[model samples]
Target: MHQQLPPEQLDRLICLEARIHKKSKEEIIQEQFLQIESEKQTDENDRNKQNMDSNKKSDDLKCSQNSENSPQKLFTSQNLSPVQKKSIITKKHSQQKKKKKTKEGQQKDITQYLQYQKKQQKAKKCEQKLMEYSIQDSPFKNKSPLPSDPALEKQLKEKQNQIAISEIKIKELETHNSELRETISSLTEQQLRIQDVVKQFAIENEKLKKQQLQVQLQTNRVRLGEYVVQREKTALVDVWIDGQELREAKEQSKRLEVLKAEYENKKKNSKNKEEQEMRTLNVKLNFLIKEEQQLQETVDRLETEKNLHIKQLKRVYEEEHARFTKNNDYPLIGERYQVLSLLGKGGFSEVYKAYDLQELREVACKIHQLNSNWSDHAKQNYIRHAIRENRVHKELNHPHIVKLYDSVEIDKSSFCTVLELCDGPDLAYYIKKYKCFPEKEAKLLVGQIISAIKYLNNHKNKIIHYDLKPQNILFHLNELKISDFGLCKVLEDDNSKLQLTSQGVGTYWYLPPECFHMGDQPPNISSKVDIWSIGVIFFEMLFGQKPFGQGVSQEKILKEQIIVKSQSVTFPQKPIISNECKEFIRGCLAYNQVDRLDVHQASNHPYFQKKLN
Candidate 1:
């Protein structure tokens, strides 16, 4: 069978065969030329041999004639000598011998030439046979009659058979290649089908996983329901216990009232003056003791009732919280306050417009939610600060300062301080809206702010509002009020300096130059720090931007402050601020703490003294 080969290999084989055939043809042509030369040589020798034979024949004929003529002449001439006859005979014999020798040499030469011609003919025929054999053996030769060489014919037939078999093998290989291609296509189709099956299996697996998750969630819900039922049972038990405690407290209060009435009657019936006086005093002391006991019982009952109410409120709150969680709403506070709307939000506190049920007034309730993420120490510190804020606001009675109505602990995690809600937006809102305030208006606002700051600084326990900024200043009916006393520090006396424990406590833009320190311990600053902040706000109000400008980062600001020491504060001339106003701002923003104006001095500046329509 023919073995299939690459096209290049097949072409290479064909070329090799053609080259071999051409080489053979060349060798055959050369051999044919040699044979032709031999034939020519043989023909030339035969011709020469023929010519020599003819010449020899003629010579022999001439010699015979000469002999005949000599005999005739001798017969005619009787007077001839016997010696002449003998000499003639001798000459004739010698001539015949020479002719014979010559004839023998010619015959020998012809015989040798004939034998050589026969050999040449045989060699020529052998070369013709070899040429025919080569032509027959050539694989590329066209089909034709077989040559006389039997061995060559046999070889040619075998080679033809091999070529036919090779063709058959090539056809078979093509068929096999087609079959293999079909097999490969079928395998690819099967692989695609398998991939589709795997995709379907993956989808089914995802559905099964979702089902499992749903079942788990259902189980969790069932557990939660059980827990709620248990909580309700516990609450009911607590209520019963509180009721029993309330009844006992009421009984004790009734007994104390009876003993007090009896002691009063005995005092009225006493006889001797000194004894009566002594008895009256004793009765009075007994009545007072009984009253104290009754009050204690009442307090106990009230505390128990309060606790029960708180528990009920907590349960209600949990239910509300669940419902509100879906709507993303705030949880209800205690029954005393109803949240109206969110007023504002800060990092640690959220202010809400809430209606106070006890006071029957709308108040701004600042709620500080105790974050669970904070460390214990941080939470404690925050709580202390809140308490301090409440205390500070309670002590302040100034008109330009925000009033604290009440502070309530809503829960362990949260507390609410109800404050006086301002009638207008904060100074920051106005600054944003107007870009910059009118000089007159700014002066009025600054003056009010200074008045409040002065009040805090002049208090018996001098207060330093370290976190003073436009955002912390609220406007009520266009009157400025200083609020947010969370960072307020109360000094022992007016002469005492405020020692800061923490750095970067307030807004960076408003922080004084001295506030930025290099050590772990914060710098000890004075009330003039608030003055510097006032100056910054004053500059912002006049120039529509901070004195140091905006967009730069806090680190850059701190570095600038450290390097320039507040000397970098620039006053622009675009707004045409009066010289007095500029000097006043400069005085407040002085780099040296001693050189900086106090709140009292700032409030009485020539800028604030200007009359406004």
Candidate 2:
């Protein structure tokens, strides 16, 4: 008896059995003829059974017993009637003829059908084997005995070996199919990657082409710009040439007009010579008579004024002499500053050496005396000037500028300004005592002055020392400091042009040419005016006298005629003074303020440069 097997294993066994039992081509044809004959015999048997219907049931029982005895005796297509067989044969033939046109599709369908049939046959065989085993184990054991043929046993072993071999082959084919599928998937992925690379190359190429176009455009623009510039330059040259031609033509026309006017004037003079001479003499005689009368009145007035001034001077002298004989009457200033001694006295103010009680330091106090006889406007003006001076001194913080410690109004009319006290004399006194300064010393002092002035000029609150002179420049511990901002002008932030006040406060000898016109209209002055004064100071330091002679009357200086005349006078031939120093003075003393050297330029002059060495 055969062992029972699972459906799947049995299916594999059936397939192996079919392959092992496969016959030759001639044998296959003979088997097909045998199948047809079996169908015809089955049909005859069916007819006979119908004729013997009474015995058909008994025959069926017998047939069932036979099929149980022999498991191979099962129902199949061979058991069909001749008519059904004929019909199936005809249908198969038609299908084969139709499928012949699609041979590959028909072959795949036939292979799948064969495998399904093999599976069905294997399932039937498994059921038959199970029934056989059940029969052997049944209580009716004597009903049938198992077949004990050695040939059958050998056939079963051979079939089992074939099944194992077929299973191994099926596994190998499955592995090969899986490997082929993986290889196909890998190839597909690689093809997709290659397509992406190609697309990227195309995109990059497009960008590169766009960049090349932009570069070409920029190059064209640069070339066009150069061409435009060249055309403009050519046009400008033509315009300049035209301007030169027009200027020459205008000059010629002006000369022609002047010549024509001269010719006409000469004709008129020739025609009216005697009449003009007679008229000019009469006019001169009348002017002389009027001038004599005016001179007489002026002389008379001067004499009267002189007598009155003499009497007033006598009275003042008498009073001062009497006071001096008694004692010095120094007004008590504020309590904060104790007056030690009188420093100096001016027309409207008095300076005294004092000690600051609060800070315990020596200071100079300048007391302004507002006289009762002064007009309200004059008093206000005086007070305003003092306040401006105080403000400038307080704001300035340079080492070479005097510092104002404090300011106090002692009474309703008088105010005092406490200032830094200097032990040494003023520049004027030093110059008077030494006669002249050495070039090196003068340069150093002048450099310091320039630095102080530069600081004030460049300060946030810009100030200009309009009245810079020797008397206002002081010395302390051999260091020069500029003091007395009484006439300093604070410049407005927006306005560049400066106008001088009506009262000319600066010394006449040191005053610039513009300062002399203060009576008519306040002249627009600038830092260059201070440079002119610095030049005069420099000249006086070198020569011990002013550039214009000290004997030159103030009236002449105010008229500015002396400045014009002094420009022509050659400097005194001194071996100590170099030509560079003379040139420096000339540059600073230029008659036109515009032509004069500014403070910055004067500070950089070679004369000062030598002092650095």
Candidate 3:
């Protein structure tokens, strides 16, 4: 009995065979049926099931060969009808008899397929056995004895050699065929690319031809116009020459034409000359640029040398001055105070640390010198200004205020004022050392400043420290003191009236909006000017920068009205200040003097009132 393959397995095997042969499934199935029938005729004594198995193997081998030989032809073969295909595949025999001629034909057809498979297996086995025998009987080791006669051994060796030769030939043929296919594929790709490039070039060539034709057509039209113009001119000349009265006119016209030609030639020559001059000018411009660059380099070198020279001179001067002060007791002002060392210097005065002869105490002596270039009237005015400063400074007496000691004229040209010395650095030093103070510390320092300013603005002494700044606030053993009364103004009335003074008197950043006003009348200055300055100082103490125009220059500040136009003071995001503190700062930094808090009002603010509670 014959066993049939399962439908699924048959379909899978058929699909696989089709793929291996690179043919349609129908063609692979048809080949399988033919192989089965041929196997049945060849192996008549074997079971019919073995024939089916052998058919699968034969079909696989045939399909692999067919795919390698004429793959394209098999792919293009005509499709068979469903009925014809089914009849060809399903035709079965139940012990059916075959004609003698049919049996012979089937045997002949199967003989080559069976013979080729037998030859392939026989060749592989011979190759394997020969390799094993050669290794076992190598010349490098002991030789094994032959079990056969010499003639038999020679015949077996020849057959092995033939099989080896045939295998090598088959491998070489397969390698050569594969190489040819690769070369053909590569050449075909290159041909396609070349065709594409040629098509693109042909398109561009046609566009260039069209453009050339257009240019030629335009030139022909221009030539025709010129020809017409020349013909008309010649006809007019002929008419003039034919008329005898017009002969002189024709001669004049010819003369005019000759002159016009000469003028045109001259114009062309002038144009050429101008172009040549332009080229010369360009050359000169390049030379000038190089010269300018060289000059700049020279100037930079000279400036660097000058700065080095100035620094050397300053160092020498300082060394000489130090030596002079150490060796001599020369600076005995008013024949009483003995100068020790320089404390600080200012625009119009120099403060020196000195010992008082009568009191035997350390004091700061501020000296003002009369310039030799100043006239007698200027000297008198300066003397009067110094005396006024002395009077205003001597009246101040408070815990936070610097005390005045005495005033003396050192010589005919120089005057010195002595005051109590504060041995510590100014508030500006602390402000620089620490970026900013915490709210509690800043409030404590600001309270001391407010207290001092309040005393100055009292009814008995209506004085305003016009030059109030971080530099003027000194620290004496950690005690805050307000110093420097050079720019202070005195109000005569208890009403705290505004005083007119120099517009550029105090520091611009600290001064109020009213101080920068320019008109027929000078700006009114009052105690409120100090309020605006205190606001800026307090803001700087908390935020490490000024509230308005922090980094702007003084000239720009005036021109741009940075402070005058400021409608409000903005607080920094950092330092996390309270709203009460912000409100107090806003009250002091008001754009209008009338809207601003006075010294008394500012001192009573909630920011300070909280401390009192």
- How does model 3 score by TM-score? 0.47
Cα lDDT tens digits, model 2, 485-557, are 8788878775545887754466777776776663566788888877888888988888788877487777767
- Model 1 misplaced regions, further than 4 Å: 1-332, 559-565
Model 1 agreement with the true structure over 1-613: per-residue lDDT tens digits: 0133444453354456558676442244344346555655775687699789979978876786777767665555556688998998799769757755654554444444445557877999778667766885675344464559989977987998799899999999999999999999999789667654554454455457546755753443332211132256447332222334455566677776677667666666655447767666696767679677767857554554444344434443443443222363433456565564456667788777666544556678888888889999999999998888888788789899999887778777888888999978778766765667888888877888888888888898888898988889998876888889888888884665867787766788888778777676667887888899888999999988987637667787766764245475678768887788889988988887888887778877776777755
* lDDT tens digits, residue span 58-103, model 3: 8976886677766664464426777886776566332333433454
TM-score of each: 0.46, 0.46, 0.47
Angstrom error of the Cα, residue 26, model 2: value is 99
For candidate 2, the lDDT comes to: 0.67
lDDT of each: 0.71, 0.67, 0.72
Off by over 4 Å in 3: 1-330
TM-score of 1: 0.46
> What residue pairs clash in candidate 1, if any at all?
2-165, 2-166
Task: Report the poorest 10 consecutive residues by lDDT, candidate 2.
Answer: 237-246
